[model samples]
Target: EETDFEKTIVDSLNIGFIPNFLNSFLDVLSTASIGLFSVLFISFFFLKDSNLLQSGILAFVSSDSEKRTVHSIDKINNLLSRYFVGLLLQIFILFVIYTITLFIVGIENAIVIAFLCALFNIIPYIGPIIGAVIMVVLTMTSNLGMDFSTVILPKAGYVLIGLAVGQLIDNFFSQPLIFSNSVKSHPLEIFLIIIIAGLLFGVVGMVVAVPGYTAIKVILKEFLSENKLVKSLTKSL
Candidate 1:
């Protein structure tokens, strides 16, 4: 169904975005190399306009059933603001760690790879894995499957180590900072949510699936049945 929908849309538009996506890869790597300043500038310009944020928050908290909607909005805004701050900090930390590791490993094009890894790290679990996979494939394929001990092995090893340590930081600190007090679904549920979203809306949907699921769950918890069964069915860390 989604394939059909996507095809129809593409056919109607007579456009393919695959090249657009691929063509932007170099530009993306270049932007990443600019370090924390670029990301901070982006967040500041796009997200720091408090007026739009306030209005959006007001609309969400003022859902049809809310009574103390205004108060709720304030609290929710506070929580989200804190989460946003923490997310930026986490990204910065990951960027610094990867960049330092790259330097330590003496990889020639390490800055570009580290930047790519840091940028991709924004997506949490899948992001790091994807980055690691890409690096491994590049290491293997670029050298024509050369002897690992001579050329590819050390690079792949450091990339994996960098990803592993980054994941630890993400799980231990970032998840708690971001998902606390939100609807924390079980791992299976999260996986299913991603699959369903991918089926329905493709790559973009999969990217946003978990957070979207969390929003839906939060709404259900607040307004739907407040039953033990519902809570148990949805519970997870």
Candidate 2:
């Protein structure tokens, strides 16, 4: 299964995406074996360590900033813990979020549809979009998967609203709390970085853009920040 998956990845890689894809695939393989669980766990770890490195750096600053950094780190740890545990609650939460959304928007079978999408949310960038695509396809293809229009409308509405709100919350709040608070890049800057990543390596690149950039930033801060040439260049520039 792993070999086949890797072959498919390698086979599909275009000349431009090949290098980035190779780097990402190798990094993923090194951290853990090729599987959904391993990949997801590594993604979660990337989110966690990104903050840990920042808090560690804060230790180098003056007393007050360092102290606040401590508080921030604690808050971050709490956030990571909550996010980590959220997996268990995902099904219930997705059902509720989507069910309510459908009820308001007038779709039916909200609970069932949303439960499925919650599963997809586990996959990062591809997940939510896929969920929507599946939902819409089902909407068009299937017979409401129910008897009553009222029930069906609420069900469908729930998925759409649930997904929209969930995505919005993630984009505006959860993402910063998890993957981005550590990086401190502005929204515009982050957008530009995503655009660059997308241009270079497609959807997966865009999704992992923030973390990859954060990782590079952390490495530079930790190792290159003190280099004589870096200091001279900084002063000169």
CA lDDT, candidate 1, residue 15 = 48
Over 4 Å off in model 2, which ranges? 1-38, 44-95, 102-116, 119-127, 139-158, 226-237
Best by TM-score: 1
Worst 10 residues of 1 by lDDT: 30-39
Q: Number of clashing residue pairs in every model?
A: 0, 17
TM, every model: 0.56, 0.47
Q: CA lDDT, every prediction?
A: 0.60, 0.58
lDDT by residue (46-165, candidate 1, tens digit) is 346755765666676645655544443444444445555666677777777777776765655666776666666655345675567666555556555567787677776876787788
The CA lDDT at 100 in model 2 is: 66
Clashing pairs in 1: none
Q: Write the per-residue lDDT of candidate 2 for residues 42-89, one digit (tens) a residue.
A: 767756586766666786878756655555555444544554555445
Question: What TM-score does prediction 1 earn?
Answer: 0.56
